[model samples]
Target: MQIKADSVEEYLANVPEERKEAFAKLRKTIVENLPSGFQECLSYGMVGYVIPKSIYPDGYHCDPSLPLPFMSIASQKNFVALYHSGIYADPDLLKWWQQEYPKHVKTKLDMGKSCVRFKNVKHIPYELIAELCEKMTPEDFINIYETNLQKK
Candidate 1:
């Protein structure tokens, strides 16, 4: 099989027209909100935002290759996925998020780990996604992820 594109624009170009509008909005939202050190690229056929190894030379664990990514958004067979890194690292926020976020939320979405899934673009909560990004920072995320890794 062919490898997925590297840029989000290229990834969008490969998707069907019917799915474009929703993904367009989500992509715009993510681009507008992504922090410094984080960038948009396709990973495993999905749009992923992470600290490139060039920037985080030590990685999250001070290792050369380990990553402490912020979030990843993907359009799956049945749903649009929002993969939040803080879901595991920030328990307090996740507890509130689990309760306060809109109902009909889908969890346990595995794309190597967990993701929140939605069937339609409208179902994806742009605000909450924004909050998650704003709340989780690359530096703090690295520390938290490394701590968890040590725990395990």
Candidate 2:
């Protein structure tokens, strides 16, 4: 169900053609709005745009060497998922977004410990998501995602 591949090419191949069209659209949305310093990458078995590991050294998650990721996206067996770590490290932002994101997204965010899942790409507000993505830089994201790691 979940996308699992070693490379971006491999990942895209796993998705059904219908999902591929949707994924391509979503991928373009992310890329068009991507801020400088951050680059398009395939992480966590999906098409994700996160701070390169070179900057954060941990890629997605708080743990530097762990498999955990800060943010990711995937075209799954049943639905599409857009994982955001921005609010994961910033509770205030999380709460704000929890209330604000729905206004545009118009779907219940399938929340996990930190990820958000949606059954279809149409349900997600890629524009709003794109805004949030654009607002933060890789260094900014790394700083936020790793904030708790520095706590005493």
Which lDDT values do the candidates have, in the order given?
0.68, 0.69
TM-score of 2: 0.80
Assess candidate 2 and give its lDDT: 0.69
lDDT of 1 by residue, 5-64 (tens): 777778778766666788787777777776677867665567878777776676655444
Model 1: residues with Cα > 4 Å off, grouped in runs:
1-3, 60-67, 103-113
Q: What is the C-alpha RMSD of each candidate to the true structure, in Å?
A: 3.7, 2.8
What digit string (tens of lDDT, one per residue) describes model 2 on residues 1-152?
Answer: 76678877788788888777777777777777767766566775677665655665554343456433546778766777777777677877688778877688656767775677777766767777777767777667667656766783
TM-score for each model:
0.79, 0.80
Output the worst ten-in-a-row residue range by lDDT, candidate 1.
104-113
lDDT of 1 at 12: 78
